[model samples]
Structure formats: C-alpha cells, structure tokens
Target chain A: MKRGLITALAIAKKDLQTELRTKESINASASFALVILVLFSFAFDLGREELYAIAGGLLWLVFSFAGALIVNRSFARELPNDCLDVLIASPAPAWSIFLGKSVAAFFLLFIVELISLPVFGLFYNIHWTQNFPGLLLVMALATWGITVVGTAFSAVTVNIRLRELMLPVLLYPILIPLLIGAMGTTTALLQGEPMSGEAIASLRLLIGFDVIYTSLALYMIEFILIV
Target chain B: MREKAIYLLAILAALVMIPNLKTVFMDLPDEAMQGAIYRIIFIHVPAAINAQIFFTVSLITSILFLVKKNFVWDSISVSCIEVGTMLVLVNLVTGSIWGRNQWGIWWAWDLRMTSQLMCFLLYLGYLLVRPAIAEPTQRATLSAFVAIFAYADIPLVLMAIRLPNVRTQHPGPVLETGTMAKEFHAPFGLGVLAVFLICTALILIRQHQETAQREIDSLRRELHSI
Candidate 1:
C-alpha cells in the first residue's frame, strides 16, 4: 500500500512538473473562472441579502465549470504521441494512475477555487473571511469529490469522439448530490450561521460522497484504463 | 423460448393490466385530500418502481459484462437502460401532471424530483455516450463503467425524500402507512406486476435487436476485411 501511494505521488509530481513548465490548464481554468465571476455579477443584480443567500451556489457553479475545463485536459493532455498507452503500460497499477491524476486535479481545482472565493466576495460585496476555516473545509471536501469523479470520467471520455461534449454530459449528473451538499453547506457558512444540524448533515453527506466515489473510481479505473 | 417468454409476458401484462385500469379508474374511490387527480399514482408509482428495477437489471448486467467479457451481457445491459430510460420519462411526465394539479406548479426542485431527474439524465447519458465509441469491446467496457457509476445515484434517489434537511413535497409510501384504501391495494399491486412484465418484455425485445445489430456489424467488418 505504501509503495502504491508512493507511485501515485510520483505520477502526481510528474504531472505537476509538466503543468509548471507549461501552465496551460491552470491558466485557462483560472481565467475562465474569473471571467465567469465578473459576468455573474452582471447577470444577477440582486440585493445584498439575496446575493449572500446564493453566493455558495454561484461560487460552486464557477468551480464546477472551471474544474471541468481542467479535468478534461488531465487525460486529453496524454493523447498526443500516445502518452496514455505508455502511462498505462508502466509498472504502476491503474488505480495509482487514477489517484495520481485526481490528486493533481485536486491541486489545480483547489487553486482555482482559492482564487475565485475572494473575487466572488469582491463582486458580490460580501464578507466571506469571517468563517474562513469552515469555508475552507467545505471547499476541500467538495473539490476532492469533484476531482475523483472528474478524473475517472476524463479517462472514460479521453478517447471518445466529441469528448469535450461527452465529458460534461457524463459528469454533472453524477455530481448532483455532491453539488447539493456543497451548495447547502457553503450557503450556511457564508450566512454567518453556526454549524446547525442541516449544515452538519450536509457535510456528512459530502464526506460520504467523496469516500464512495473515490473508492469506486479506484476500483473501476482498471476496467476503463485497461480497455 | 425467448420469443415464447415475451409472448407469455405480454399476455400476462394485459390480463393483469385490464383489472388494474378498471380498479384504478372505476372502482377505487377518490383520495380524501388529493381527489381524483391522485389516481395518476397507479401509473406513476408503478413506472417509478419498475424504472428502478430495470436500472438494477442494467447494473447487474453491466457488471457481468465487465467480468465475463461477453457481448450478450452488454446487450442486456444496454437494453435495460433503454427501457429504464423510457420508464423514467413516464414517471417524470406523470409526476409533472400530478404536480400541476396538486402543487399549482409544473415542477419542483425538491430533493426527490431533482434526484429522479438526475437519474434520468445519467442513463440518458449512458445511451448518448454508447454510439460515440465505435469499437465493440471498448464501447461495452466504457458504458459498463458508466452504468455502474450511474447506478450509484439510485440509492440517493430512493432516500432523497426521507432526508431530514431537504424539504420534499412528495408523499411517503402510502401502503406502508396503511392510509391507502384496501381497494387501492389491488390495483396498485397488480399495476406493479403488469408494469414489470411489460418492461421485461420490452427489454428482451430490445436485447434481441441489439444482439442482431452486433452480428450485422461484425459481418460487415468481415466483408470489408475480405
């Protein structure tokens, strides 16, 4: 198990090095997120209260869309020169490769989300920093969930035709529950509410979702990658 | 034998269905709070139940296909999803019509409704993604992964209505509460049986077509190679 994790981390480190060299997906996703945030403020001219109520939904919506942009490229980047086949043929197990991609995606998405939160606060005229720890926990759990599913699906769609269209169609529905949990918890935290029963339940649901999907992706990635 | 079973199921479905239609429409009294519009549950609830059942069938077959690497399981899995998608559509439309009457709105974004819609879209994605990948083994493998992933939502949909945090306008199980009239039970029970039999028949027919299509494609490939 330790060796497997080390292999996964090595793969993630390689991906990070490649990403650092080029800075393509991160740049594109972060810029897309910022553009969407600016456009969202223009789209909805709600009052302070209404914006706060929905700030969670708006923020996560940006994250999901931008996250998709990043995750799609996670596997797509391997397409040139048949890098995917080489990666699959390596000594590492398929689950390790899947985990490595997810870990890298988690980093990319987390950075984009970190960038988006303050910008979202700026445009929406809300003070989100008061409950920083709570909000960060919510973001981390939700981002992990997104990366696990997104990376697994990236593998599935990478070889298909019109894969860009196929990825989101295949992805968002599986994400409905996770998004619902994230939205609910984020909304409550932003509203300056205590960790109420509902928020706690939502957090539990989020954690449960992350665990289930991550394990599932680990178990199923071999079937997808080997074929 | 497969053809004979399909015919037998079709006949059984019709026999079970006629009494259900009469009982639901003519014999059962109107629900106290919901009135006659509530009668849609006979169709709606049965479709909803059978849709879940068919999805389960697909999930099983999908796993089998991955394990056995057989095209037959792939065909059965895809057929179940197709029939299941149709049933989910039926459930959604009927639920919408009923909601229009009862809730004064055509749709509600409550947990139950939203999850059911999510299930529908997920399977619809399954169907949409299949034709995009042309290779037989790869298509079967990838779609099986999708089917298994999508089936994870079924438990959530089942439990969505009962979750404490989210507000749901959908009713709990009336049969369990014994609030449904004893007369309503006959139609409801028979309605489920009829829907399942009919759904099974449709799945078999579609599975046959899918297998035949696969054979044709393989033959065409042979012709090209020759």
Candidate 2:
C-alpha cells in the first residue's frame, strides 16, 4: 500500500514534470478559459444581479470546458507514441496511474480556476465570500469529481478517431449532478448566507460525487488504459 | 420455445391493448377536471412506464454482461436500450402533444418532464458513443461502464429535476394516492400490462437479431480464413 502511494505520487510527479517542461495543455486550457471569459463578459454583460444569479453555472461552464480540454490533452503524449503501453508495462498498477494523472489534472484545473475566477469577478463586478474555507472545500471536491471522470474518459478516448467530440457527450451527462452540486454550493456561498442546510447538502453531494466517480474511475481506468 | 414465448407475448399484448383502447375511449368516464381529452393517459403513461422499465432492463443486463462477459447479455442490453429509446421518444411526443393542448404550453420545467427528457438524452448518449471505439471488447466494456452510470443517473436526474420552484404538470403515481379512480383502474392496469408485454417482446426480437448478426459476422470471418 505504501509502495502504491509512492507509485501514484511518482506518476503524478512525472505528469507535472512533463507539463512544466512542455506547458502544452495547461497553456491551451488556461488561454481557452480566458478567451471564453472575455467573450462571455462582452455578450452577457450581466450586471451584479444577473451575474450573481448565474455566476456559478457560468464559472462551471468555462471550467468544465477548460477541464475537458486539459483532460483530453492529459493522455495526448502517452497515446501517440505507444508510450501508454510502455507506462502500463511499468511497475505501477492501473489505479495508481489513474490516480497520478487525475491528481495532476486536478491541480491543472485548479490553476485554471485560480486564473479564471478573478477574471470572472472582475468582469461581473461581484464579490462576497463569508465562507472562504467552505468555498475552497467545495471547489476542491467539485474539481476532483470533474478530473477523475474526465481523466478516465480522456484515457478511454485518447486514441479514438473521433478526437475531441467524444468527451462532451460522455462527460456532460455524468457531470450534471456534480455541476448541480457545485452550483448550489456556490450560490449559497456567494449570497453571504451562513452554511445553511441546502449549502451543506450541496457540499455533501459534492463529496458523494467525489467518492462515487473517483472510486469508479479508479476501478475502470485499468480496463480503459490497457488497450 | 423462447421464440414462441415472444410471439405469445406480442399477441397477448395486442389483445390487451385493443380492449384497453376501448376502455379508454368509450368505457372509462371522462376525467372530472380534464374531460375526455385526458384519455391520452391510457397511451402516454404506459409508454412512459415502459420506457423507464426497459432502461432498467438494460441496466440489469448491462451489469450481467460485465459480470459474466456474455454476448447474450450484451445483446439484451443493446436491445432494451433501443426499445427504451423508442418508447421514451414516444412518451415525449405524446406528452408534448397532450401538454400543449391541455396545459397551454408544449414544454415546462416540470420536474418529471425535465427528468424524463434527461432520461431520453441519456439513452441517446449511449447510442451515440458506441461507434467511437472500433474494438469489440473495448466498446462493450466502455458501454457497459456508461450503461451503469446511465442507469444510476435516472434517480439523480429526477432529483435534480425536482426543483422547489417548479410545480409538475405530470400527476403522481395512481397507486401512490391510495385509489385508482374505480373505472379507470381496469384500463390503466391493462394498458401497463400491454405496454410491458410489448416492451418485452420487442427486446426479445431485437436481441435475437443482434445474436444472429453476431453469428453471421463470425461465420464470415471463418469463411474468409478457410
């Protein structure tokens, strides 16, 4: 078990190293989020009331797409050169590989959020946060939910001829509950309300989603990656 | 014997539907609120129930395929999903028509309707993603994984659809309310029976075709090797 954790962390380190050296997926997804935020700001121009109303969904829309973009690219390097076969043949088990890659992708998405959230606040001119820790907790859980499933599908569809089209079709339906949970949580936090029952329920739902999909993805990614 | 059973089911379903239609059109009294036009329930409700049940069948078969790795179960899953998809579409169109005429709108954010719509879209997702992967086992495994989630999502979809803000046009389960409204019970029960039988028959037929197709493909490969 200790060895497995090391193997997983090693895999994550490897992915982070590759991203640091290449900056390919992170660059593209971060830029994509920025462009979307800018474009949406122009078109939507939802002043304080409207922006707050939809801020959660709007933020998630950009994040989900950006996260999908990053997830799609997570396996790009491994897929093209028969590198994934080599990686699978290595000592790491499938779940460890799934874990490492998802962890890396989760951080990548958080970085994207780090960049995008401020821009969102700027464009929408909204700021209210009584629950910083609570909000971060929700964000982390939601991003984990996104990355686990997204990374699994990213590996699943990595080499397919359909390329990018398969991701949204497969990802969005599964992500609905996660999105709902995030939206509810965000709405509650942004409203400056105390941690109400609905907010706690949403947070709990996010945690449940994180548990369910992440575990399922860990179990299933082996089947997907062995080719 | 299996084929004969399906034929019998199809015939029995036909027998039930024929009289049930009369019970709906002529025998059952008009609803107190919605009147005779509301008789559409005799058709729409059964289709909706079958849609859900058929997807549940797909879910069970999908799990069976994963556990046993049997092509037969996979075939059944495919067939049930197809029949479920068709039934869901039937439900949507009929409900939309009913809603438009009766509720003054063709669509509303009503919880059941939204969830039902989500259910239909989920089925479409299953059908759409099948062709993306070329290898058979991979496709089967991937689809099986998706099928599990698709089935699991039904309740969540319904839950998400149930917004506090939106009241539903769709009525609650008849049995849930403790009474089946006397004369309406026979037709309603028969309609559900007929629809369930038809759904089962369709699944049987489609599964047979899928099995045959698999056999033919294997034979073609054998002949080529020879």
Best by DockQ: 1
Two-chain DockQ for model 2: 0.51
Candidate of highest TM-score: 1
Q: What DockQ does each listed candidate score?
A: 0.63, 0.51
lDDT of 1 at A72: 96
Candidate with the greatest lDDT versus the true structure? 1
lDDT per residue, candidate 2, A1-227, as tens digits? 77878888998999989998999999999999999988887777556677788878788889998999988877876877788888889988988988999999999899998888878777677674466677788889999989988888787777676869987788888788778878877876776767777777777777777787777777767667764
Candidate 1 displacement at residue A127 in angstroms: 1.1
Worst 10 residues of 1 chain B by lDDT: B156-165
Residue B27 lDDT, candidate 2, scale 0-100: 73
lDDT of 2 by residue, B1-226 (tens): 8799999999999998997887788777777888778887878889988888888888888888777888888888888899988988888888898899888899987776777777877778888887776656777777777787777777666555442345667666542465667777788888889999998998898889988977887788889899
List where candidate 2 sits over 4 angstroms from the true fold: A128-130, B1-3, B162-166, B171-178, B219-226
Task: Provide a comma-separated list of chain B TM-scores, one per candidate.
Answer: 0.93, 0.91
